[model samples]
Target: MSYMEENLEKYADPEMYDHLHEGYEVDLKTILKWAKQDGPIVELACGTGRLTIPMAQKGFRMIKMDIK
Candidate 1:
């Protein structure tokens, strides 16, 4: 397995991983605006649902998946 796959759980747990991002915010708005589509969205590496959760709350259909 790849190093990331081996350590996937460490990154997958929100409680364990969320603290790693403490204050960082991903700018999904610009990406959304640029895409010009509300989705059905396909999100890769959707760690802790950071962007995915909000977009889903906004009513976009999200397919969230991650290898880690």
Candidate 2:
């Protein structure tokens, strides 16, 4: 089986993942601080776009990717 097939259970519930990750902003400040505002940022394994959406709102061009 492929990687995604094997990991189906892990990525099955997006809502659960979001709930678990909600209010977790430990990395946001650092990421914004280091990342250039005028940017085309590529975020691999960007599950549920938690960071991608915020960055895009801040005017960053986001290329988000995930298997599911």
Candidate 3:
């Protein structure tokens, strides 16, 4: 497995994972926004950076990471 994949193999806790994803403010509009721009951002243990993604969509660079 990739180093990234290996590291991320741990955030797989169903209960916590579900709750985290449930907390993000995500939408198609936001994704579209990010698709049009570029900058630097990192969603460490990202679990869905509801805000991070939208911001990234709005033309910022970003990297996504998760802890296993």
Candidate with the greatest TM-score versus the true structure:
2
Q: 10, model 3: CA deviation in Å? A: 14
Better of 1 and 3 by lDDT: 1
Off by over 4 Å in 2: 1-8
TM-score of 3: 0.39
* Candidate that scores best on lDDT: 2
Q: List, residue by residue over 1-68, the lDDT tens digit for candidate 2.
A: 89868877766799998998898877877899999867599999899998999889988999999886
Model 3 lDDT per residue over 1-68, tens place: 99977976666565676575675455645655555443466666666565566566566677888554
lDDT (10s digit) by residue, model 1, range 1-68 = 89867877566567868788765655786756654354488889887788888777877888899765
Candidate order by TM-score, decreasing, is: 2, 1, 3
Error of 1 at 54 (Å): 0.2
Better model by TM-score: candidate 1 vs candidate 2 = 2
User: Would you estimate the TM-scores of all the predictions?
Assistant: 0.62, 0.81, 0.39
What's each prediction's clash count? 0, 0, 9
